[model samples]
Target chain A: ELGPMIVTAAIGQDTSLEDGDILVVTQKVISKAEGRIVDLRTVTPSERGLKLSIETERDPRLVELILRESKSLIKIDSERGIIIAETHHGFICANAGIDQSNVAGEHMVSLLPEDPDGSARRIREEVAQILGVRVAVIISDTFGRAWREGQVNFAIGVSGIDPILDYRGSLDKQGSVLKTTSIAIADELVAAGEMVMGKAEGIPVALIRGYRYQPSAGGVAYLLRDPASDLFR
Target chain B: ELGPMIVTAAIGQDTSLEDGDILVVTQKVISKAEGRIVDLRTVTPSERGLKLSIETERDPRLVELILRESKSLIKIDSERGIIIAETHHGFICANAGIDQSNVAGEHMVSLLPEDPDGSARRIREEVAQILGVRVAVIISDTFGRAWREGQVNFAIGVSGIDPILDYRGSLDKQGSVLKTTSIAIADELVAAGEMVMGKAEGIPVALIRGYRYQPSAGGVAYLLRDPASDLFR
Candidate 1:
């Protein structure tokens, strides 16, 4: 649905995805296309969800959905009314990346796509087949940081691009060996793409051209920090 | 120094900073302009610096500078050789944001700008006077996240633009009342700007055009989180 729909939207708007273009798409539209929208009115809270809802002061049914989506909870600060959970996809985010905003109605909440990397690959293949142009796709979602205030969009899915620009062992302009300078390129590009996407205005996609990224099958999994090295965890 | 040099460089390159354009300048160049660069050979390690250096397996002279620049140590994982400290500017980063990359030589390291927000304002003012065009300026630095791998550029200094966009209390298109959806726009824009900047190539500045950010005097201080609310600390 996403690959065809995105192509249709582009053609309808008199634009085309050029060769070597990176299409940054929001995760909301991808989830919607995958029928991940859930109605809170139809949900019932489990015992643990009910207790957590009371502690966090959230809707019991919504908490149930979040519990279902998460593989483990990292931080449960009842005082701050926050639950930082490791989602099924190994992403640690608040409320398991579930949100009611940008959905159709108040009772509607969307879950993250079942397989975000696969979702991106399918879109890339279909787009290439239809237009005969090679392009990369990224699925982005806004997530809060640990010490930083507010949220910025991060790459949750990727296809046809190496996620990180590994600059370790590379030489700088001054002939100094760069150490530990691998940049999270997919995350940066997604955050860049989010600037053009009007969040409040419901613009879910942005076209980023002219950036020459290393093509690789190594998906967003590369962006997730190894738990052993992560000090905060 | 940054203001004049940046303007001169723009003229040299025959590029003009247009109105509503956000200029993203990396912190390294600003520090270099401000004489924040230090030769590791010139520093004398203190008693505490020597002890910490051995534990963290870092250069004693470099550790001495990091200790002096930091207000407090947040995390010290000797096993990982990672020291997360709160910089004087209130940024929590490794080695208090001291970096040897992008500088003249391996012996030299760049400290973060003393007053990042003021540095941004100076660039904005000088660009306005030279080109008669108003522009927002952001001083950016690459930082590692707690749960994520690699680093994305963040706004450590901001001028002529509000660092955040608060969408709380606004009605969505579905007529639902949104809550707690403030975005760190300055950080996102910096990451976007980093895409064009060749890190290994030593390109320190990037220009972003056509983003309608709200102009404000609220500096990057707004991006720092209150320690009381931060769960990681």
Candidate 2:
């Protein structure tokens, strides 16, 4: 009850969440709640998808979902067979953060929660009403980076918080013009929480303490950078 | 001697080295060491640069570097221009992690260390000799993401450690296949260290404790993803 179970219970209980409380819910729980399970057997791979499977070396159904979710195809590596893509969320993560792990049955996959931010907002509003206090909710998933090693958890969906803190026009110690822009505070928090919520552990959720954050109108969408403005794009 | 010293003697003393440690040196220190200062009086803007400046509303020298480093020109706003390019290190980031901040005088700009991985390796070797222990080094920089808010610190150069940990054939608790490919532990560590080394605090180097990492033959250059194999190129 001290880990994921406690987190699950806390979500259901009526209580007030405070300013610094962090509700760490696992992607699996969110996926389960939203009924995002995709049965691989039910998915009939199209001829085009079969050809893509031969080309990309990925499960046909998963490849189909990835193709459907992608805004634009970036590349297809034959060796790894990874179809790197820009998901609907404008994130250029591998496989669009799709997964075939931790499903209840054979040949089952889980899509990322549809409208994750909306789901987070709904949960935050409902929990606030029950507990009579404000709180921040973050839905996390594992992601790979372009030129770095190892996967770390990141916040795919967030609510009741400003994920990025803009510090433009501030002053540095040397009386210099401070143009250091946004700080991805929410993503850092998610990564920090992942340290305790290890991949091998069944602890899918954790409650973060001690860190303080302020509410803003921007919410999580502010964390999504427009590709047009991205120099790395 | 532990909390915030203000003199040159207080920085990089013989006694300040340790085993299995990663030293994160700021660009300011590297610029000061290498004497790569651009005095405004000596800077003669090219006519083309000046005309581009007028159109873009930015410093001509800065824009010149941006243009030279870019592989493909993306967009140009009034004060900001975006370009996608592979850095000299083969990693892709904005403006190649160049900056106009924290310079000693007006119109002075600092380039990234001539060879960041070399600098890191040199520091690691020096510190290891001094302390008689194995150590790792990572030269970090703040960079903007393609589709994310806020800049998180990432490893521009690394040595003595593996940047990515591959977990392709691992198993989950439920006897499921874990295709969790790679994890960017080093970059994540850098981001976590930024929490302690605030941009304004003048504390560029932080000593991270408790976490343990393995040694590998592959150095920091291995962290750079090949654009051909990269999914997000």
Candidate 3:
């Protein structure tokens, strides 16, 4: 598992882990450690996957995997060769969070971890046993936004941390009530950690210290908005 | 201006500024420092402002300021009391980034800086002259996401840094080329910096050191998606 590996690497790098520190791990490493790899050559496409493959110009086998991982299809931009899908985990991303990059071979792709929050908990437990320090664990993945051109890393799973720093009843500097001012701090923490864990560099973990984050057992599911309330979805 | 104030606070905290360091400042403090404030009693609502105020259940004067700052309106969720608009700077946020909180008085509202990029450049110059060190400046504001439930601090102004870390031609761990994997490092940096700059606590500045960034004169315009190409606008 990547949990003990992360502890070894932290000691190797001379990083002294402390209580309340955050450990942000990329979803790729967790997926790889869990054997969520698929060999495209060994897979067969379904009828719907073949039709979608023709439209998205993607491999039929890869499309089949995407179909299996997705709960529903959100958009099919055939002109752009992109398929926006909602994963079974309620994540809206391109190709159901399945990607061909950063894997073992050209014909292999990695699927997201089946239980991300559970993965976070297991890793947190492993690190606590080895490192002798309690730290928050966040599993993050990169995703595209609605009106933004570039993508930012967001939390898919969280453990030992509250997802949001709510300020609904907090008063501002002027003594005025802040009605809707909760900060999605878990998402921000992952985005910050992504800077150190750059793509194509194989750096899967980032440590954030000195930021006092609220501790909780809240998972990343708190960040997802319901489609009935989300206007864009 | 907030430039000298930030340097003073850093000195008080015994932090030394270094080259390649990033300074993320909140927009609320910059607006308050720049005198970009208005009294609600001084504003006279127009015909369109009154019409929108009735539907949105907002003050007509506040609606007038939102309309003046917005270049175009995208969505008006009357039931939610939200005015999703494309600001003159092309940022699609609620109420054109105007807010009544964080000001000095109950009837005062703060408007976003007229030129955020210029504000960043000015602050960058101010810090260089005082501290005798080069630092990248990013002005951040809390913005609500379209699909997410809470808000995150995003860079609205940037100077002395390239907004994106382009990894298009870079090869991944599997030796496969990453076609579309540019990281929005500026936005990610601000998201990290926001951890120190908590909302309603009056901590409007954050210092991030030891991060190596490619220097450029690129502005925050690089982050905005063109409406023509955006799928969900």
- The candidate that wins on lDDT is 1
Docking class of 2: acceptable
Which residue runs of candidate 2 sit more than 4 Å off their true CA positions?
A: A1-4, A8-19, A46-57, A68-80, A119-135, A147-150, A201-203, A206-208, A227-233, B1-23, B34-36, B43-58, B63-80, B122-135, B231-233
Task: Give one digit per residue, the lDDT tens place, for model 1 in B67-158.
Answer: 99999999999986889999998999999999999789668999999999999999999998888999999999989998889888989999
lDDT of 3 by residue, A1-233 (tens): 77789888888999967888899999999999999999999889999999999998988999999999999998888888888899999989989999877998888889999999999999899888987889999999998887776889989999999999999989987788898999999999999897788889889999989888889877888888989878776
| Candidate 1 vs 2: which has more DockQ | 1
CA lDDT scores, all candidates in order: 0.91, 0.67, 0.89
Top candidate by DockQ: 1
Ranking by TM-score: 1, 3, 2
DockQ, Cα level, model 3: 0.80
Better of 1 and 3 by TM-score: 1
How do all models score by TM-score? 0.98, 0.80, 0.96
Instruction: Return model 1's CA RMSD, one decimal.
Output: 1.2
Report each candidate's C-alpha RMSD, comma-separated, in the order given.
Answer: 1.2, 4.9, 1.5
Per-residue CA lDDT of model 1 for A94-154, tens digit only, reads 9999999889977899999999999999999999999999999999998999888989999
What are the clashing pairs of model 3? none
